[model samples]
Target: MMIHGFHSSRQDFSFGPWKLTVAKMHVMKSANVEKLADELHMPSLLEMMFGDNVLRIQHVSGFGIEFNATYALKCVNNYPGVLKVACAGEWEESRTMGEHYKEIIRPYDWTYTTDYKGTLLGKALKLKVVPMTDHIDTEKLKAREQIKFFEEVLLFEDELHDHGVLSLTVKIRVMPSSFFLLLRFFLRIDGVLIRMNDTRLYHEADKTYMLIWAIQGLR
Candidate 1:
């Protein structure tokens, strides 16, 4: 089973320094497992029966901060009434010095919550940041700098659950900075996480032209 696309709508709103964008995608009433698998780009149909729907959110700031989170509504034995949920995310920051200024938080671990409403989780991971060559000795670069990149707290609550209606509510707070941004995603079928990739090319010595290529040859 595979799904190609869906009907969706997007809305954007801003308040002070905070910006919010929401995208709602409707699942086709007659959509089957194959269609769902195609829409999610999953390789196997068996995986499609596990997760019935997905919700994804991402926040990015001009200051090089990136955060992504995803939630999946899973069905037990293809029974819609028996459901389980999973959530996870990744956070990172980078500055103008190309990859040298990059800092990454360790990959997040997914956790389940029985109470969809009033559920809160807090986690702290080791942060690793690259050292600047001009300010620090070359030998010292071997030992990257470590700091408390951010503290994250996740809050989830159920918003709506009428017949043929499914909604997920999520609230998150990141500490040490006061920037707010939001982008919402609603996906039918599970395991789809929203992601963004920003790439830049830097100059190298010898003044010769250099080009990098990414090959996606099928096996």
Candidate 2:
């Protein structure tokens, strides 16, 4: 988690009543804060990290007690003068100090409250007081589409081979779902089909990798 040497004094902890110490307020103000992730129906992101399963992050600078989507929605619904609340997915911003901020939030969707209601705490915090809630969208891709796409694009190989100075053999079944294209090569040496090596190629747009087995012939 990131500590900006600033503290806040919030009370409700559910929404705007929760305040950050003055120091933290200054930090948030000075830093360009952004959400990096947007998930649904999950507790605070940090809570999940504490569990036995290790959580993985990409391009993460640090962690913190982030603004809760539910809390933000509630504050917007109940309190006046609250601004709009919205869930933001992975975000990165270039800031003045030559430091970049990247972060992720959960539930992928959020509510917005306006600050026109003017709660004393909200005024002090200079925030609109949006509260996040349990209302989450449950939309998913259709099963047929998923299956059809996978069937055409993805393939698995039970065995593969490579040819080099000496032939090599592998026993694992490699799948093509993750990578763009997978090529398998087999070489005959001493009446035995052997595998030389495996190469992985990644597609830039989707960031997917393709494996090419037995690529030793090229320099």
Candidate 3:
């Protein structure tokens, strides 16, 4: 069976709320925090960025409905209260899979003194990032078996056909108080599992935020 999940609405993809949260976190203020960025809330963010109909299948063995990056970016631009798209680059041709995944983990600077610094542009982009190691150590599975497993699990299931996935589960860290992070998951089809983790900060060009990702096809 082909199982799929829904992303957030079209209005929830902006980094404004996420940026504001970071500002508050840095200032150590306890005021009421409203969610703005998709990082903190993946489902809501997905919904907002991709809409309820982002993924759908026509029939078994048929090409499923898909969403594209152009559409995804357009949705991101539609959110309310966006000061501007702080992220730099065209996103389509500018970023590659490796750079894009790196951006998702902490896409913000966890440390205060980085190139991007404390601004949303800095905080939303990734600086130095790495992919997590696959923990399955074994002589039982042949190298090709392992390779095939990972390829089926990670690369195939992800929404890569549309927009390349920027930042995956291995890098993202969700809040425990609300338990929003626990519900999130990376894609795994046959045997591959990508657990994206969130780091802090992103990379930018010419004083503008750029979408960064860290990608690995592993066994």
Q: What is the lDDT of every predicted structure here? A: 0.25, 0.21, 0.23
Ranking of models by TM-score: 1, 3, 2
Candidate order, lDDT descending: 1, 3, 2
lDDT of 1: 0.25
User: Which candidate would rank higher by lDDT, 1 or 3?
Assistant: 1
Tens-digit lDDT track for model 2 on 116-181? Answer: 111122222332224434221112111122221111110111111111122111111112222122
Give candidate 2's error at residue 130 in angstroms.
Answer: 46
Which candidate's lDDT is highest? 1
In candidate 1, where is summed lDDT lowest over 10 consecutive residues?
87-96
171-215: candidate 3 lDDT, tens digit per residue: 112221110111112322222233332223221112222223323
Best by TM-score: 1
Instruction: Identify the superior model by TM-score, candidate 2 or candidate 3.
Output: 3
lDDT of 1 by residue, 82-179 (tens): 22233211211211224543332122112111112111122342122343333212243233434212222221222112111122233222222222
By TM-score, how accurate is candidate 3? 0.18
lDDT score of residue 139 within candidate 1: 43
Error of 1 at 124 (Å): 18
